[model samples]
Target chain A: MAEGALTAELILGTTEDVLRRYGPAKATVVDVARALGVSHGSVYRHFPTKAALREAVARRWLERWHEGLADVAHTDAPAEQRLRDWLSTLFEIKRQKVREDPELFDTFATLMRENLAVVDDHVTGLENDLAKIIADGIESGDFAPRDSKVAARAVFDATNRFHDPIYAADWKAPTIDVAFSAVVSLVVSGLSVPD
Target chain B: MAEGALTAELILGTTEDVLRRYGPAKATVVDVARALGVSHGSVYRHFPTKAALREAVARRWLERWHEGLADVAHTDAPAEQRLRDWLSTLFEIKRQKVREDPELFDTFATLMRENLAVVDDHVTGLENDLAKIIADGIESGDFAPRDSKVAARAVFDATNRFHDPIYAADWKAPTIDVAFSAVVSLVVSGLSVPD
Candidate 1:
């Protein structure tokens, strides 16, 4: 079963690569199969149609992103540290993907915006987790009584906005890092207990 | 001379409309000249090439933006009120552009990013203006002593980030206003002088 899963993962990765290169309109099952050096029949065995293949690829990518989030969600790190790590992870992924192909970055951004409903559940879960950590900090007297939900949303939006340049492959990491640190520090200081 | 300047301005507006309808790659000088119901030779009299016409349209847009800033820079409004108006005007213009044509947004954003040197200078001027206001507030015992440069950058980035959805045509005014207030309150609360 493990070997089967690994094969499936590899096939999905290849499918996404083809999709990114050719766009959804031209990225057919046969195209993916050809790129993977596999028979069309073998591709059909895994994904019955092009739509199914695309759906599977998107789901796989979201699952991988969630898995990364899960890895850090419950770590023993302080709340601020966790938030920074999460923001950094997001930027790193975006930057690496942008470096791979600018068109792919645009495609991914458009897909995410157009299909927010598809990932709503995962986003909600992440938001809840973030809010809980923030609330914990407040309860422990480390943070002020700012609205955690609003704060979390601001952090999410600010970080995502900074990824625009990254998606366009025009980002300077140091400058972006400075912007990121400023945002994180400002928010944290705003929420910190009075001296 | 005034008549000539008015004709040039009209031609610029017509060209912007045409370029916005069809992007620079597929858009043509003939199309713009035709749209304006002017002779192709007339357009050639003003702009030698399609590239020159596109650049003029972009320059006009930037000029209008800077003019708005200059008009408000010497207003007698308090620092916070001036800051809010500046942000609002910036976003209102973006929202108007998105409403005019969604596709034009990508064109504008792309042009702005590609010309970051010019865009950065505009932002730096705004930041310097904001820093002075912040410094005045500090001296007047309304704000705390924080790194004005860093703090100004944070305010600029956060407010600009909030304008993303407006440019995308996915934001409501009330929601964005709430967000604007949140950032403003966060900054003032975080950096305000204690009584």
Candidate 2:
């Protein structure tokens, strides 16, 4: 492989593939290089270290997970409806990742632990998306005026069980959807202006 | 020691000490037996297996943790006030455990994972306490008439981040208390019957 042709994105995709096949504990920078038909030095040029590579992979995966929700946050709908849709979409995305790609989900979860800054950034990004919708709600008089950022954080924290990976096992419960709906309703109710 | 002196409570207390000193992985039935000046055989007669002993210890610990909350659940105060007090108290108890005795807290968390049935039962017991408070609120017309059991579960799940061991690391953040109060206020607002 030509050295000039190897990019960070290319290296990250190969690393993700390596992680999927070998799992988090055994996957390494050398594996990514071998998969890319390049030397480990080439991969190092892109990621600098194994930790950096893992962090990049986790960040990219989390970024993709919330892209749809960002769109939902900005949709031209009633702020309440948009907030509901945004949260539901976010929950469904996480639930699907847990249910459908549990191996990859587990891999990212392990990576996320070692990459706390990336996880924090991802959470902050999602919270910002939530805050935008909440701010819109306040402007439209649908919700009571409050600190949108704080309200967003509260809403995000309130639904931790539905979206947080640590509670992934509980997501499969028969009543999980009902529980999710209940939380969303309560949160929306809490935000709504009293009639 | 007298044969009759080897009570289950004695064994459990010794086990907790052993666990706190040696941690969840290293602590064993033999250590508990050694600490109590009894044969491992005598301990086996009461707990049957190491797993059983660990489960019993975890159950006792969790039961103790919630004992005070059970009182708050049954208090004569306004249901809303009682509910807030119960939740805030529960959060404080868990936060203290995480901050003041992280090692012991971690050992219990590991033991709890191994003894999931014990964990589930403990959660159900706590939810029952919450349900009782919500039922009272409904009766007093402070909250809308809803399924108290379901509302209890929702409240418990919603506040999970403040109390769940996995999120313990985030508990020490400067804004955690504010974030927690925000969630509690949102939850209480959601439960109250709007005028």
Candidate 3:
């Protein structure tokens, strides 16, 4: 990486650390710069404002989430299996985040809320990943032929209760796993081509 | 109605008005009592506590929601049409509440959150209503044989994004209606018995 790019990467790492330590509300550009043993001006050169820095950190976090699911989307398994695995993996990833470090998870959620454009882009990317799996199912004659992109959106919306942040509180319900299985089964059945 | 029962009804009506005017955070038993030209002690005799009064108001609101959905659940239409209409009616009712008077809707949401038991009962009642429709579909040989209660719960969870209060923001998206239709179609197809 170029020298400036390397510095920017270091700044983002320190910002993540500061956010983890002090939370979104208290974390500041000065804290990140101080942690890096650099001046606030240096941080400002890389990120125009505090919000920009926070948005970058949130984007980085979401990028990791996408990367985790990308493998499942491209696996060689049958399309139906891949789709189930993909949705389950996504739900597990989100649930684990909440379980392991809810404070940090909430921090990123707040940052993401402030960065609506970033969230929109991330959602669109996820839909595209789902579309790829649905397209494969259609090609394999397992799923009914339809617009994969549209199908992907419908599936994503339908499963929102399992993975959406607002529903995080209900994630711990004893029957949540069963509910997740039921929903995935219904979606798979819905996609199956009728005999 | 008996005199005490009448007084209790009056107290609840005044509580609703007070909650709507001041929002959940500021509304109090004294406010309700004052609005009804009764002493705070009189309100307490009916509700016992401010929380009790709030819970009653929230329960009343949810009761009305159930009443609205009860009609679609019992209609003479085909099971499939009734299911679709029931789900759509729920989405429309919730969306209208949010759109027509967002402040009051939010107030009720706050009250509902504070009263978890009331929320749970309300959810169970909705799921039962859905189960009735699913049971009818099964009886008519339109839907595959399965536990109607389980299928109802699954359908309810699958369509959470459409009616859940937390997703109120997305309800306004231009494509939301199309998305609702797609989900409902997928659900209906999922329930259909194969040859």
Question: What are the lDDT scores of the predictions, listed in order?
Answer: 0.66, 0.88, 0.86
Top lDDT hit: 2
Over the stretch A1-195, how does candidate 2's per-residue lDDT look in tens digits? 899999998998888899999999998788889899999998888888888888889899888777777889888999889988988898889888888988888987888888989988988988999999999999988888479998999999999888878778888899999999888888888888978
- How many collisions per candidate? 0, 0, 0
By DockQ, the best candidate is: 2
Candidate 1: which stretches are off by over 4 Å? A1-11, A20-25, A34-49, A96-114, A119-122, A163-168, B1-7, B20-25, B34-45, B65-78, B100-118, B165-167, B172-180, B190-195
Residue pairs clashing in model 1 are none
Candidate 2 per-residue C-alpha lDDT over B57-165 given as tens digits, one digit per residue, 9 for 90 to 100 = 8889898877677898998999999999999999899888888988888897898889888988888988999999999999999987379988888898889988787
Chain B alone, candidate 1, TM-score of: 0.70
- Scoring each candidate complex against the real one, what DockQ results? 0.40, 0.81, 0.77
After the best TM-score superposition of candidate 1, give how far the Cα of residue A12 lies from its true spot, in angstroms. 2.1
Write model 1 residue lDDT over B103-176, tens digit each, in one string: 87777776675565656666788787677766666666776647778877776666655554333644544576
The TM-scores of all predictions, comma-separated, are 0.77, 0.97, 0.95
Residue A143 displacement in candidate 1 (angstroms): 2.1
Off by over 4 Å in 2: none
Q: Give the distance in Å from residue A78's predicted Cα in candidate 3 to where it truly belongs.
A: 1.1
Q: Determine the backbone clash count of candidate 2.
A: 0
